[model samples]
Target: MRIGVIGGGAIGLLLASLLKQTGYSPVLYVRTEAQKNEINEKGILYLPGEITSYVYAEHIKDLSQMDIYFICVKQHDICSVNSRLSGLSGTVIYLQNGMGHVDMLHNMTEEQTIVLGTCEHGAKKRDQRTVIHTGKGKINLALYNGNAALLTRYKEVLNDKRFPVEQVADWGIMLIDKLMINIVINPITALFQVKNGELLTNTHLHKLAKVVCSEACAVLEVNEQQQWKRITYIIEQTKENDSSMKEDIALGRQSEVEGILGYVLKKTSHQSSVIHFLYLSIKALEEKRG
Candidate 1:
């Protein structure tokens, strides 16, 4: 199967490398000239573990020829890049950070086949061509537009390779669960300028994470209309690693606090004033840092 990977950052490049490693020859399509030069010049170096070796890709080409496309750009760029990628017939995988990216991409694709993919396969770029796998969380997949054939093909690859894949019927819950994790873990870590684990050392940080998670859980319980989410479990998952947002802030990169905390605060009508406070505080923190 021909897979197309968009964005050459950690997530996109990692997924593309995994697919290619497991007998699926995939083409990687990146946006920037710098990224293109990096991928072409050095190729992708994926290290799943300390002992794992690097894998180079052969089908590096344009975006249209892909049978499955992985969209892994930052949240703000989702709409613009997806708009440019309007005419693809393949299933698109959203592997970026933050929540609401699928909705933005949905607006661009018009009910097009999309994959709501999640991975805690923690990756950080060692260099432009190399990425280091920091943690091992299973990859989850959900079908949005309802293509059974595409879903089957997706599961087949993931399952055969022993990659964790779940075809969630109601991905909004998954989105909420992820949002809960991102909301708490991301901001506190960013605000404190600490690793994900460092938040635990501060009693107030732990309380703050709980507060953010609680707010997110409340919003999810009402808005997405689901209860299967594990809010506490989500918060605890990234207690050790540095959150993507925290890392972004430390590196002077923009974050998705707007998409994660701001979305729930603005879109969902919650009566709790504490939720509003938490949301606003996080928003201000991100802006000040940005």
Candidate 2:
């Protein structure tokens, strides 16, 4: 199968490496020619054992042919590539972090199959050609506007022991669950400049996280207690790993705060003080870093 993995970020490199390890020569579509050339020349360096996998690397605009395309870009950057993705004949799976990109899928061609997914794996791009797999996690996928059979077929083709893939019945619930996790973990970690485990180790941060989680659950109409348990469990699993928002702040790149907390603000009629505070806090950080 001709699999096209979009973006050269941590998630894209990790997915490309997994496909290569699974015996598929996946084409990795990066934003810059420099990244494409560098990856093409050096191949993808998957860390923790120093395994390298050689795969096809092409510029994002050069994306034309592929049986399946995995959109691994950030939610905020989805607009830049949505036009090209909407016209593809093959299946396009969006593996973005938040629910912000869901609206763009409505404009895709009727004939094209669209899949939405939430990634839980902790990945960090060490360099253009190096991706460190920090923690193992499953990818939850749901059909947004696609054939049900395609989900079953791709689940078999893409599933592996190292990188597992699971199917979900409802895309809304799948994304909401991921957003809930992000809303609690991301802003606190970014603001405090700490790892995922620090939320648990530091009592003060843990209390703040619970408050943010409760506000998010209230807006999304989900159970706060149940979601807090899940959030704590995720923090435990990815204790040593850095949250994506933290990395973005450290690197001075625009984070997905708008997609996470900003989305919550838009959903509710009543004001969410905690959520509003976090939403503005991250935006302020972005400006300061810029």
Candidate 3:
């Protein structure tokens, strides 16, 4: 099946590589002509051993030909291309960190199918043409509001043991579950400039992670103690990996703090000083970096 992957960031490249490795010719939708030319020429390198796989990269001008489109851009960055994707046919799978993009799905044409999912896989962009698979995790997806046939079609194209795909009934809970992980790890790691595991090692940062997670749990109406265990579990699993927000800070790019924390803060009935502080700090970092 022909597929389209939007965003040239780590996850996009990883998805493109996985699909290419599985014998599907997936087109990568990138922002620049240079990226397009580079992927077309040298191909995307999936690293551990720097193995290269070729996939076509196309400009976003035409998404009509794709049978399915995977929106892999950051939650905040999705807006830049939102209008372009509005009328496009086929199933649109959105892979984003927090709940911020949920409202956008409401704006989709009735014909446009929405599949919401989160990537558990950890990937880092080593360079313009290379992405390293830091952690292997399955994808959990559910239909927001669409025909079941579309979900089945995407599952057929993407499901595999290496990159297994599972269907969940409630997309809201699935995303919030991911948000729990992101709200804890992303800001703490980004603020302290550490890897995912370091949070567990440092007592101060570890406490901070708990504070944020606790506040988020209260706001999201999730069990605090239970979600804390899940957060710790994630830290154990991805200890060596870098949080996406940390990478974004290092790269001098805007983060999804707004989507991750901003969204949660809005849901909160009470004030969380620590979460608010972290949120403002990340926004300051984003502005300063810019």
Candidate 4:
């Protein structure tokens, strides 16, 4: 099967490279001509310093044709990109952070299949056309079509040795859990301009993180896992790399706090919810920076 990648960011490139290894044809589209030139020269380059094998492929600047489209843009940019890729009738896999943005994309194009995906794998752009593999994790998929076979077919693209995928019902709720994972950690790291591991030493802040995590669980319906469960691994991962939000804030760009934290408050209605604080605090923090 052929796949069209709508972004050349770390996650988008990684997914394209992985699909290339799995015997599927993939094309990567970027927003800029500079990135397009850089990627075409480097092809599908991945530094798998921490992981096993990586697949490599070339990027296409001009859109040709495709069977599937993977929308890997930031949560805020999905609307604009979907507007451009309106002709493709293929499935669009959203490898974005947080939840609830899918509905906005659906409004843009109804004929296309919008697949929701969460990547546990950590990737950071080292430079134009270069991305470093900071960590490894499975990708969970939620497809719009009710057909389990389509889910299975999507999984086949990532079913290889390096990147296994899991399919689940209620992809929106699944993304809620992923949003919780990003919210507490990404913003704190960005605001502090510190690595996650370094922030863990601050007991008060660490406790605050747990508090937000608890609020997110309540909002997203994720049962509490444990103190040293999945979070511990992330704490260690944060030691080496700054978070995505950290990178965004360091570069003076806006954060996805709305998609990550604000999504919870918006969905919960804040009528009788503790997560209302998260929304207020994050907004206040962003406003102060302004």
lDDT of 3 by residue, 116-190 (tens): 999999999887789999989988999987798879767866788766898888998899889999999999899
- Model 3 lDDT-worst window of ten: 59-68
Q: List the candidate 4 regions with Cα displacement exceeding 4 Å.
A: 21-23, 48-62, 108-111, 225-229, 268-290
Q: Per-residue alpha-carbon lDDT of model 4 for 2-73, expressed as tens digits?
A: 778777777887777667656676677787777776666656667764332233333343665666677777
lDDT of 1 by residue, 4-44 (tens): 76766777777666665676666666666676666666667
Structure candidate 4, residue pairs in collision: none
TM-score of each: 0.84, 0.97, 0.96, 0.83
- Model 3 collision count: 0
Q: Best-fitting candidate, measured by lDDT?
A: 2
RMSD vs true structure, all candidates:
3.6, 1.1, 1.3, 3.7
Better of 2 and 3 by lDDT: 2
Ranking by TM-score: 2, 3, 1, 4
Better of 1 and 2 by lDDT: 2
Against the true structure, candidate 1 reaches a TM-score of 0.84
Off by over 4 Å in 2: none
Write down the lDDT of every candidate, Cα atoms only. Answer: 0.66, 0.89, 0.87, 0.69
Q: Residue 2 lDDT in model 1?
A: 70
Against the true structure, whose TM-score is highest? 2
TM match of model 2 to true structure: 0.97
What is the model-wide C-alpha lDDT for candidate 2?
Answer: 0.89
